[model samples]
Target: MSKKGKSRKKPRLPEEQDLDTFEFRPTGLNLKWTKDLITVFDGYRIHRCYDLTFIERAIGEGQMPRSFVDQWRFIRTILHRFAAVSPKIPGVMEKYKRRQVVRFVTLVLLTIAVPLMVATFVFSITAIAP
Candidate 1:
């Protein structure tokens, strides 16, 4: 086939292919959200601490009972699920949608009405004088 006549193939997207074959890894809360949350906590001078070594040690030493590990894994999965659901965009969109519509409508009316209002005031004053 001549190069001019041949069609170029598009690159494959891994996510678009079979999901079962894909190895999905979890990344913790995104940087912006984490930073925002940290800002709120920092504003109040709150301290946060976590010690995950205990879990590692328990697992390495076989001290973690099977049931305990199962429960912890379940809890971790639940937290990850919740984190997946909760984020800033949807909440922000909702907040703006709730209050912003009114603010925007008010702004639009003011923009249209201000000049007319000034004209009316000048006309009324001239009428009063004559």
Candidate 2:
């Protein structure tokens, strides 16, 4: 007699084998095929560029707002909205890169400019006092 506790396990399909982390990873043939196509057409004129770029979100924002999973998604939403206006590949990429530059400037402002300004002010005040 077969034991009731013993159960047969079913094999997982290809779809089920993927992990959640795989969603954000660059996989499959598109990247490789694109590189190959570019190599053939462009030859020596342009080098192959395969970049997996993602947004950077600062600390303390993770899971803060119930809606956003993280800052990356938040930044993505902003960039996506900005790109949605044009929706063309060239236009979207140009705008996205430009907007990313602006974002980087803003980050520098917060991390560097504001702190320097505060330090300068404090130093000037202390210098004037004594």
Candidate 3:
């Protein structure tokens, strides 16, 4: 295959995510949730403060997770088991809760809907040209 047939490099996002702006400190109240999150994400090598912050960023702020959609999905998958318990995880509530709705909707739009739309647009253009 010709080199042109292969995809070019992806562009860097204009503004790099300021992950430094956030911090996640596990506490006495939410200790169980934090431990459970670690257990659920086992083998992903989540070991540092930054790792927790990244997950928090993804779920709470609607920012993209760093190449860990599989783990992210797993984290979300167990939500039914953990989300409604006594003390909620700090990251997945209010800004990222079913109660708020807006954050979740925006996440869906950015991750799923926009990508689909872009693919359709590209397909339509190529189909029309040829």
Candidate 4:
């Protein structure tokens, strides 16, 4: 318990870290795509792009692919489709935003409800058991 026996550790700065261990390398295309995607979401007033559920909902209508490869393909397809068109077209952007909002809200409600239903079923069964 003596103060002399205690050692304080200092946090390491980014410059102090080893460069070889840093793995993230964003290519120009990747950076551009990220920027473009952010812009699209901003236009739609959707700011939860970092959320996994939001991303899945936005790209695949809340139905996520079973495998990583399929998920990547699905995402790439959606990104390409988004990049190919202008959301500024009259009525198109509004329709898309409305659809996305509905999908996201429905998915969120279902996510909350399914677990509650399962828990309620379990409790009911346990309560009825001798």
Best by TM-score: 4
TM-score of every candidate relative to the true structure: 0.30, 0.31, 0.24, 0.35
Winner of 2 and 3 under lDDT: 3
Please estimate how well model 3 matches the true structure, expressed as its whole-model Cα lDDT. 0.51
Q: Which lDDT tens digits does candidate 3 get at residues 1-130?
A: 4675777898533342333552333333245556656664453333212234645664575444344442444344344334344245565455435656877778877999888999999999999995
Pairs that collide, model 3: none
lDDT scores for all predictions? Answer: 0.53, 0.47, 0.51, 0.55
Estimate the Cα RMSD of every predicted model relative to the unseen true structure: 16.2, 19.1, 21.7, 17.6
Q: How are the candidates ranked when ordered by TM-score, highest leading?
A: 4, 2, 1, 3
Error of 3 at 49 (Å): 21
lDDT of 1 by residue, 75-118 (tens): 33433444444344357558658788999999999999999999
Tens digit of lDDT per residue, candidate 4, span 1-130?
A: 5687668788432233333563433233345545755665455343223333444464465333344323344444444445546554578778888999999999999999999999999999999999
Clashing pairs in 2: none
Instruction: Point to the candidate with the largest lDDT.
Output: 4
Worst 10 residues of 2 by lDDT: 50-59
